[model samples]
Target chain A: MNPDLLPLALGINRVILYSGYVLLAGTFTFWSLVWPQGRKDRHLLILSIAGIALTTIATVAGPMIDIWIAGMTWAEVFSPISAAALFVRLAALAAAAFFLVDIVNYPIASWRRALPLTIVVAIAATMVASSNAVGGPWEVVKLVATMGHVIATAAWLGGLVALAAVLIPRQYLAELDKVIPRFSIIAATSVVVLLVTGTLHALAIAGGFQELVTSDYGIVFFIKVAIFGAMLLMGNHGRKYANGVALRAAAAARASKEAKINHDKLTKGGPGMHSLAVAMGAELAIAFGILLTTSLLVFVAPH
Target chain B: MSRPQYSLPNLRRFLGACVVTAFLVTAVAAYYGTPEPLPASVDTTSDAAAATGGPADQAPATVTIEPEPTAAGVELPSEGPGVSEPGLLLIAAPLPDGTWDVSEQVMLAKPTTSLTLAPADISRAGSQFGFARPEATSVQVSVGEQPVVIPEARVIEQVSADIPSTTRFEISYRLDGATVTTVPSTARRGIGAIMPVTSGLDPDLPVVVMVVGETVLSLSCPELSLSERNCGTAAGDEAMILAEPLPFGAAVVAAQIDIPRL
Candidate 1:
């Protein structure tokens, strides 16, 4: 078995597991906090269950695959060299368990609050800490930056999926007026963290602008940035719709009952919700492009 | 155009399309755009031998130990092209202890320690010798008590008893099946050691070998504190380079000499 394939398998496995993890965390967070009295979301529950299952499989199979690549038997997995890999596997397992717990107790306001999401975020942080991105100098800065990048990616991508899959499907129009603007804040903050941390990581690994153009690492990195830009455009489109709904709702609160009914038609019985969902879905697609580029980046050797 | 379906299944299909696209892109990048393959070790010994009008036969060279050297207080087997007289034929055969025992002709009997020397083929003509061991692994050669350091160039000539005054030699190292060639400096006028500064060369085997006239000198590997895996890198590489030459005084004075384990 070629050891080079270990990173590829691990990266793809992480993509699957992280996508699931982020979706579950984001969906549950929304359900617990924003729409506590929101309809029981069967789709969200089913997706969470499936995500947890995939993460569980990924968490177990990752180390086993690596052991095969290292040409070591299962007995040698406890060796010191395998320690970091082992820690990652263990942390992923713990995160999967937390996700499992959250799914089993679906729609329980207390159970779904912040705890599972925090665990997943912490797991992602550990992953960055153990990654090759933090291998060079200024260990603290690199680890923190990489962690921020990982978390922000998950939040943005996962949150978009939750909005399109869960909230939109249920036609939670009143909820969207509150949640979309709130999520836009989260997305905006995440984009800032991503840009700053991503630049730092690129500078640390890529050396210079010429390297970004010349090397394989740089080529894929630029593609990721392009996709992120596309995602931003789509996100901004959805943000405008959400902000428009929020503005109309405020105006209706101050104005007559006729104005309030008009506002309800604009959000609920109209094309506004469908348009927002379409834009958010496009953003979700671009998010996958970003994840794909990220996985490629992991596989490419830094110059 | 038609209000754009936003049902759960439609969203699932959209997300699924995204995942599939990502998967294809990642798979294509991983499979198609991987790094270039590592260079294979090249063996130019045959070409060198052919240029020198040496042995054309690919068969292993036979060595005969001179009996007089056994009686001359030095049991050093006179083998290959360097041997002046034929006496005993040196061959690697399995002993009763399960480990392959090198011919008694090459090694002096020591009660505390036994060594296994893998048979290496050498081709030579007049005063030119070529050595090659194609196999990645060879029989283990063990040293007892303490590691011996080869003496400086001047002493090597005195101990070997047949030193060339103007030995023109080229050293080549085999790394991952590719042979890299380098010419050793003949300025020492006697026995100049050949050392590899490159990390590409394997330290366990004949990464670099020196030929003095027609005689191929077998270098020694010191029992360093470094692990076998780390022996060829970092400080271990430095140590190996420093320990490149055999102690001429000890090699001639002792019962037996040490050779590298490939």
Candidate 2:
């Protein structure tokens, strides 16, 4: 492999891996935190499976590429660190798949729903620990900051994707009043955590503002942050539309005591819901842009 | 006017377009954002053989050096505070027992907290040891005054250390006992030392400096035979080896030094 192309290849692999993590983690966050009563939708399941496949590919391919770059033999491809990381990731994926099957088949209690979320949090920590940044100074602080960043990213971006899965298909139009508010709260909290942890990570890795602007890593980091800002704006717009739909739904419920009102027509086919869908779709698109810039950041040297 | 219906198919199409756009933008960013590829190592074995119209194993032509014998023996070239061309500086002293005491100094343009040094390949043309490969043992590395510790078995033929903040460091190792032999089909005998012209150095100028305390009977760079400047200048006691300008990978500096006795 051409050493020059290694960074590009690694970045692409990270995109696939990160996408999988966000989708899977987001779906679980939606099920557990946003809409506990909502059953597993087929589209969400498909999205989760896709995430598993992408993560598996990245987990397996990452080590192979590292070994090849080091000019090591094939037998040495699975070094101790690589092997441990791969095993933990694969085990987490398998457990997630099992939990998804159970959620889809059985009507489990709301408390048991946190299993997948816990698993994903473990996966997030594994990712941070296995990164090249582990052996550096302030190791614990960096790991905690990075893990928090990844989890918050999964909650926000992944939850947005899960929201799209349900909202676009009008799968649970009646529950929109409850679902949208809950998701808004989770996303708001996530955005706050994301900003805090992201700043800490940037300060720790990039060293200072000068390095962030001058280095390749800094440039890509800036781009990711810019895309994230765009996502936040779009998210705010979607929340407003969601609030409009929720207010109208509450009013319809109050008026329905006197006369029959078509709840589906009021919530599903309304302009408010349409605007929310468009805004969310745009947010998801921008989220992918953030993921791409993040993947590039992995290969770029910070200072 | 009716609001646009966001059917499942429509949503999928919109997302597909977004994904394509994201990929295009990311690809462009990556193309410009990533570091440039390293230069490729120049393989000069075939070219050297073809130039002389001799067998591949034929000994490379040698340049005999008769330095003005000073009373204090050969003085190694002085490396000033600032390095003009940052690369490896190798100084070898021929011991009475037919072994060379080698000390390699790494000069990098950028300051690094850690450094990894790989053993040189001794099988190349002009190396004194034809078949016997010598392992670097009792390797000691220090950045100025602080001695860096080397782990026992992380890599093969390589030693890495988390060194102090410095751009210049020295690695000294003993070549226990290498089987000394002459180049094939030639009576010339010398010590051949190959060092790397590390990346981030001026490829157009001399990147490696080899100094031998004993008198230099013959000097030649087998790898750079095809270039216009096949070899660099040999002063009183040191030889400067020129490196071919390669864009990406580190180039090899193969120097064959002939002393009075091997």
Q: Whose lDDT is greatest here?
A: 2
What is candidate 2's CA lDDT for residue A170?
68
- Give the CA lDDT, 0 to 100, for residue B216 in model 1: 17
Residue A109 displacement in candidate 1 (angstroms): 7.7
**Per-residue C-alpha lDDT of model 1 across residues B1-262, encoded as one tens digit per residue:** 5656896646655654565455445434433443221111112121111100111222211111222211111123234211222111222211121122222111121122222122222111111112111121222211332322222311111121211221111111211111111101011101111222111111222221222111111121222221111111011110111112222111110000111112
Give per-residue CA lDDT, model 2, range B1-262, as digits (tens). 8657896645655654565455445434533543221111112222221111112233333322233333333445466212444556666554543455667666677788867766555444332233334456566777899887765522236565677888788777665334232211111223444453122334443344443543332233444443332343334433232323321133343333333332
Question: For model 2, how does the per-residue alpha-carbon lDDT over A1-303 read when each residue is reduced to its tens digit?
Answer: 332244455567778889988988887777778875665578888887888788878877775554444232222233233334456666676666544666555543466766777768867866875564453456676778898899998988988898888878865665777888888889889999999888778767766678566655576787889999999898898878767776676677667864235566675576767778889889989999998877666544321
**For model 2, which pairs clash?**
B38-B248, B38-B249, B39-B247, B39-B248, B39-B249, B40-B249
True-vs-predicted CA distance for residue B125, candidate 2, Å = 27
Candidate 2 stretches with Cα past 4 Å from truth are A1-3, A68-82, A107-110, A208-214, A253-261, A267-271, B1-262
Estimate candidate 2's RMSD in Å. 18.5
Cα error of candidate 2 at position B206, Å: 8.4
The Cα error of candidate 1 at residue A8, in Å, is 5.9
- List interface RMSDs for the candidates, in order: 20.3, 20.0
Q: Rate the local accuracy (lDDT) of all candidates.
A: 0.42, 0.57
